[model samples]
Target: MMAQPLLCEVLIDPERAKGLSLQQWDLLIRQARHADLLARLAYLLEGQSGVPTAAQRHLDSAWTFAQRQAQSVRYEVASIQKALSDLGIPVVLLKGAAYIMAGLPAAPGRLLSDIDILVPKPCLERVENGLLLYGWRTTHHDEYDQTYYRQWMHEIPPMKHGVRGTVIDVHHAILPPTARLKPDSSKMLVAAVALAAEPGVCVFSPVDMVLHSATHLFHEGELEHGLRDLVDLDALLRHFGDQSGFWEQLVERAVALDLVRPLYYALRYTAQMVATPIPPFVVKALDKLGRPSALISSLMDCLFARALRPSHVSCDSQWTALARWMLYIRSHYLRMPFHLLFPHLIRKAVKKRQGSGSLTEPIVVKE
Candidate 1:
């Protein structure tokens, strides 16, 4: 544990680049790309002491894409704001979109797949209808798919803009009702902070923001972007760590939100992977609510240590694929109760078999 991965070492001290040979830089670049962190590393190393010209070109290209993505997110947010304005629904931005709008340190070079927003459950119909009017159409056409989403999920099926091809995930809650932990959506909605710079756009309060990000990553099935997400957690922690009572508030909110488990996972991995600074007392406070048993903790360490590394070939051992598959199954197990889960998994397997080589290919499973 004394030595970190090269990518983590470089992130912790960008000045370390002065010592890395071209071959090392090549491996690092590949690692970052597979982790979905090439751009974030680029942002971190921009003016650091020694970056080779060849590597700079690749980093620069990623930076350009990140810049365009930020601007595009802004335009799309504005369009969404306008679309919901008349209905008086508050659009609570989440994750990447929230980071960008709020000018969080995490925003820079943050690559985003889609915009996510939260509205009250009562407003779901109105919000969907309004978005439809703005050329956003429900993309899931299957009857079972629609029922699966509506009957037992956190958010509805994703909506894609007919014209722009951008996707949005609209949520009324964080965790699905079927999920083991259910945080009160109403409290988050009430506590949301409005972005004065961008009217009509609200984001989770600082503590809520941190908790949600933790919950999103640790509770999810997929881990291909695991390291990128761990980086996001590191960034948010570093940015917010200095605020008065920030750590205390984080611990308190995690308890209040039934999110201590995710918070523990977040704190542990961010610190382990990227050296994210978290107060010892804050970690200690969650011993009862968050910490797993010693045996379980050791097992998770084995899984996450492999799963959270870059998915690049260089990072894998004989067990890497199995580690990720185990975590994927673990996430789905935590997502819903057994009565619904067993049947759902069987149905999905059957559908996958039935849809092979057809236009109605089975959905790529995700949280």
Candidate 2:
């Protein structure tokens, strides 16, 4: 049996690419694409010699496309900040935009489909209107989706640029108002680090960035980009893990934010899959603080072991589909109690039955 996907092996040790056959490179590229890590692979393998000419061409192309996309993100974010600058509220960039603006290690080779930002909850309406006046319009025109986002979910309906086709998600919080864990958005906002390069723009502190990435991936209904997100966590950790007191700050911050579980899963999976260098003391700290029940822990190990693999034929067993499905259901369950989740499931089921189903949530999962 294949113990790990070739892409994962290459990720942990880019030198593995030095000896691969062209046929193996073909398979690796396909798997990396499926996992949304093709460009990331290119970035990691850069400067490494012995890549076949054909493979090098594809990697170069992927990296170039990613670079172009990253540049576009910068322009779009500037427009977004300018749109809301008059409102006088600090605009907190989230996810990809944040990574790019903050110059985090996760920014390079990342593909961003939309721009996300967080503002104070009280400024939600004003921020929405501010973007509206700048020619950004809300998407998810369906009434149910509008309500689902405005009422329960983390952010407002996704807003897109009429001329540029850029999408922006403005948020008051990371997780939904209805979610099980209630991390204090106010606390996070206070700790947000202002970007020196982009005045009036800020990102979560290093600890919060890692915690939010973990929470988003583990709580998401879709696992299509699971491996990609895990890679982001790996980058964030490796980068931040260097600062003095970073490991202790991570533990304390997770406790303060009530995000220990997601942090635990992030650290464990990144270590398992990417060979992310996590210290033993940090693992021991979380093991006591956030470890699940024995039965649940074993089940999670089984499920994520399968679900976190590259979603490709060569990388998975027949059980992979089942694992993804179960994790999807589990994500919904984790976010909301049965009472709330059941109705949403039924509504979505009816839509699927009618053959016009669309997820109420945005394509990119919110916290």
Candidate 3:
């Protein structure tokens, strides 16, 4: 086994990587790639003399690949904008697309698997029809699956372009209609900022952008890329934290949007795991917004700490799987009431056991 420093710590101070052997560097690269941070790692190591020549080559290759992929994603976004322009719908870019369009620090060296956009619920049908007319087709064809997405889910069924095979997720809201936290999607749309570079594209406001990222990371059952998501949070904080009054506005916006808890968790974990620089007074103010009790927080700390690490075999432990499962259950519970959740879980389990292809599970594409 190779001795490894914490990846986040190494990213913060690449000089600390001076003494790592080629084999250890190989391990680090593999772990970083698995966590979808390879290109970001490459970006951080640029111009650093401490990295081995061979390792530097690998990082450069990763960086090249990321740049090419980002370019392709931009093309796709342009096509989507054209597809929806006739409808005159306000297309709000979400997640990776938003990061790229806004030219955030989180954008460069970030690998995007698919594009995500949001439109008003009333305009969803028109947007969907326009996409299909422009050669995009629903990845899910089953009636049950289609109904499930339309009735309960926040987004329409995933669609892929017929010729290019590029996937896209079109969301009408950030959370499911059945979710416990009913964030006002209209307000989010109203507050969105237009991208100067992209005429038809808009992105969430600075504060809402962070809130949505936190909500996506914490609310989802998947932990495979939790650490990468944390890295994104760290980058967003470091980049935006520089502006005067940013922290206060973030806290205030979170409160206005009823997203204080997710912001609290985002701050707590990023500070704990990656040493993200959060202000003392900001933390103090958010602490008053009803953080989880000490016992629950401690338990969450253990689960998240284990789950957020790279999912490499060398890092695996018996407790990690249990922690992931617990968080998975907790995520669904948070999203839906027990009455709806129990039946949903049972149906999913039965479908998995039966090996049915009719109902495909939602795929979380990284970017």
Worst lDDT 10-window in candidate 2: 358-367
Clashing pairs in 1: none
lDDT of 3 by residue, 132-189 (tens): 9989999988787898888888999999999888889999998887877777888888
Query: Candidate 1 residues 1-367, lDDT tens each?
Result: 3235688788877888787899999999998877778999999998876788889999998898888889999899999998998987678999999999899999999988889999999999999999999999999999999999999988999999998888899999998898888789888899999999777789999889989988988888789889888988898998889899999988988888889999999999998888898888987887767899999999998999988888888888889899998998888888898888999989988988897867432422112
Higher-ranked by TM-score: 1 or 2: 2
User: lDDT score of model 2?
Assistant: 0.88
- For all candidates, the clash counts are 0, 0, 2
Question: Residue 230 in candidate 2 has what lDDT?
Answer: 92
RMSD of each: 3.3, 3.1, 3.3
Model 1 alpha-carbon drift over 4 Å, by segment: 1-3, 353-367
Give the Cα-based TM-score of candidate 1 against the true structure. Answer: 0.94
Could you give the candidate ranking by TM-score, starting with the highest? 2, 1, 3
Report lDDT per candidate.
0.88, 0.88, 0.84
TM-score of each: 0.94, 0.95, 0.93
TM-score of 3: 0.93
